[model samples]
Target: MSTIEKAMEQLNRSPGNAESVKPKLQTDELSTKVKIATAYSEKIEDKEVSVSHKKQKTLFIDDARLKSLGMISLNASMSERLVRDEFRVIKQKLLKNAFGVNRQETLANNLVMVSSANPNEGKTFISINLALSIASEQDKTVLLIDADVLSPSIDECLDLGEQAGLIDYLSGEIDDVGDIIYPTSVPDLRIMPAGRAHHMSYELLSSDRMLALMQELANRYSDRIIVLDCPPLLGVVETVTLSNLIGQAVIVVEQNKTKISDVKQAVALLNSDMNIGFIVNKAVHKAGYGYGYGYGYGYGYGSKGKNK
Candidate 1:
């Protein structure tokens, strides 16, 4: 078998306790490293159960609720077409990275994370919109995961109450990952809530079980794209830990509000080998275009080495 196929087989057969291939990071030391990088002024679910037989939970999102939040919804009107087109461009780039001829097959290119340098930069907004956009694709399936365990808002954004999800599975509270994956009103879109908070969230995210689960998600379906709504890159060590598993990242930068230094610092912590993209949230275009979000995709700031 080819190396990629063998690796996929190994991932499929690997038990939950399988050792994580990614190097472990010392929280305190990593935190210190992040701090210094900033000071330098720009330096820097184990489940055997099958999903087919299980009766999955359904997540119902109100169109009005989405409209109130200024998010994209199904059956978008002419007025919402602009935002949809914007995300169409964003998702096309991601899909190309995940499955295009130039794509990296070994890495988990199908798994993508939507995050930001700091909180309230509209990462969640982009995450949901991106997932919605991809779901509209005729041949693609999307899973929207709320990985911001520290402060989960996806549930609220989708008008959902507290639900068992990533935290529950990682903490061994939930055995079958399928149980936590909720089918949304949008046919091609599914969601996994952030579950309850825990003091050991950082450890849980970096555990072997988490790694195994990621492998499973990445290889489960050839056309599936997993989009994670993660915490801000700074302060939260869990976000950094989660970055090690995914193949791509989209960092949201709030046009006038986000600081360039913070963005640089946050980018410094990401897996350099991964394809990192940027989204300028709440941007104001001149004249007819009015105010809207902007997006751009590219490699890391510099150097070709993966973040270690």
Candidate 2:
């Protein structure tokens, strides 16, 4: 069976009626190719086009390097195949929620934040994989942002060199939004590494400048999706502050690790304006059932401290 079929089969086993998930699920039918606007500068006719949001910088990434890190396979292998298919299922759901007919009314539904209640629960793992999976799409582009200023991992995971990011733009260290965005060798995938750490990260993330940046990102290209790797919700004030600005949230709960109370507390901190969802990470795959990471749908855009 295809990945979506496997996912549907898995969801059918849930307590809620299986029919409820049919509308939310979608196959990988790519729409017509959309023109990709550059986020960085690109030369045309040898004359600088005044850097009109058309920035394209390169970050070399190897498929071998990625697989070594236990990420989804871009090539071929049983384990790699399974992981890739798994994320395909996950990303399809996310994309539907962002652009589906019944998508949430949030203005910035394309802006998604992937976070967890505690550290080391594989939140980063899921974030990176999700970005990669989305990038593989024929009709979409992705920006994997490292919003975890204090403990960013996107750069390190991809073996990128030191670079400026969201903080640099918000703090006035950088003038152009294009300056911080780095395009990866992966087609349709770009990233913004966490810039130089600042003691006032929370203040800066919640600043008016940050809000404007989000607006620009949201209103830019319709096909562009921004995935943020945010800090753990319970301990970091930045996560809560940043949550208010996003239209969608994905809370990654490590199976058998994160406490139910902690997950509830973390979800409580998010703004209800978002379409919140859950990802059960690090679960063992059952034979014939495929890998078993559950997707839980939590009610309400703004949470109120309840677990699903």
Candidate 3:
């Protein structure tokens, strides 16, 4: 048997203990170094789980609610002109990094994540808005995944009803990831809610199942962009584990809110090899300072969006 086949066989036969079952990374040959408890074996079977082939469930989003959140205009053209312009610039950088330009290959560009040093820093707000903008792209599709299993807010933000989500599939409550991925009323945009919070959420996120699911998402569609709204980088074990599965990381820092020392620590949690960037959530729109025509929030893009 080939080396990969033998490794798979060994993985399947071993007790599901975190130490015994090491899942291979989807993007690279190395395995995850995060130690995950093996109790998930009861949920995961020997057979491989396929996500790309399955049909997904569809959910409707409330446009009015999104408008109230300043996400989009009533006419559905990005609500705040300033917000839209800023995000346009941000997404441009991200897309170029994802698809590459002029034959230059971008590394770990498709799988992008939005995180922060702490809660209430507007990471969720930025994540949802970024997904919305990316969905507007002509050729690309976007999947916004709520990786914050501890305190999920995507469903609530989108005004969605209770539904089975990522946790259900990871815990084996559902056999297919397509069942958990919900296509939204918004065209070209889909979402995966955090689902029922599991006590072993951290472990499950770092498990073989999680790795398999991420691999499927990353490789299934060449033009697909996954925007993960992960938990805070510091003080969250799950976020650090989830970071290993993605290619690029966008750290959101609130102006005058998140401390500089905290931001440093949060960035340190991610793998050094990954491409990392920042987005200043709230900034004052002054006379100059790169501020364009008047808009909302005075949100500034600092040091490539590093807050002042």
Candidate 4:
């Protein structure tokens, strides 16, 4: 009555095949054939997915190009050396907080956010420099995420073209996060561009998915560090939202430009328990020879500021 029974009956009725007619297929045999076909199909599907992932582009950051952009490069020039040394000191403290004995005190100590009181305060500059510095570490890798979706600049700064990135992953536009995280020419550096701008940038940043992604990034690798280039804290609700998910915060204060009140207010909006640091950008010493930069580490509003 069933299809298998009908096929068996036809095989038995065949004229010359009567002698060759085999016993009816056991249920397990039929099931085994179906499983083999399903497995073959699954293998084909997996191969297609793997091929698509292999097509994801790698971001190429030219050292000469970075030099032209006035950013630190792979060169060994004196000025570049000084800049690298400065970030070296900064990254040391960050690395200490990320993986040191006190690391257990912070929720996501490996996740650091670089932001400013307002835009054009050299936050992006610090973010890129910090990431580059960390990438140079012998025992660690860094993933720099452009989280300033409203005014993304990492791609432009690195001469990277538009591509799907953090937003694409957070908004469910891309099913896999690995698809947007691009490898770079730098040895241990990776980058996630701010994907296509959306009207609900704040909502997306504050979404549950964003929090889950942050948790995954923080715990994914024991030797990996994540640096988020966040928007200026003032007037950006998204930055405040992001502060909650990060374990460390670096506020870049432009010398003679950023207001003290703005710094206090921006700091007020951040997670009070976070390890906070300040970078005085473009500060000039009494001699007025070259730009003097200073780093101060603190905790919460009652921070014991120690300049390094």
* Candidate closest to the true structure, highest TM-score: 1
TM-score of each: 0.76, 0.75, 0.74, 0.74
Candidate 4 lDDT, 1-308, residue by residue in tens = 43222323332342222223222222221110001123223333322111124545779998976655445578858644556665776677678767877456425778889999898877887898889989999999999999999889898878889999888877888878889888899989999999998888777887666766776787677999999999889998878876776777878766567776677778777655566766655533323122233321111112212111
Tens digits of per-residue lDDT for model 3, 177-256: 77888888889999999999789987777777886677667667889899999888888876786776676777776655
lDDT of 1 by residue, 1-308 (tens): 42222222332232222122211111111110111112111211333333444777688888766654556767667765556665776677678868888666666878888999888777777888899889999999999999888878788777799889999888988887888899988889999999988888767876766767777788788999999999898998877877777777777766457776687688778765666666656534333222332322111222113332
Candidates in order have lDDT scores of 0.68, 0.66, 0.66, 0.68
Return whichever of 1 and 3 wins on TM-score.
1
In model 4, which range of ten residues has the least summed lDDT? 27-36
The window of 10 residues in a row where model 2 has the poorest summed lDDT is 32-41
Error in Å for residue 65 of model 1: 1.6
Query: How much RMSD separates candidate 4 from the native structure?
Result: 26.8
lDDT of 2 by residue, 94-120 (tens): 687677786654366788899988987
Provide C-alpha RMSD values for all models, in order. Answer: 14.1, 9.7, 14.6, 26.8
Candidate 3 positional error at 100, Å: 1.4
TM-score of 3: 0.74
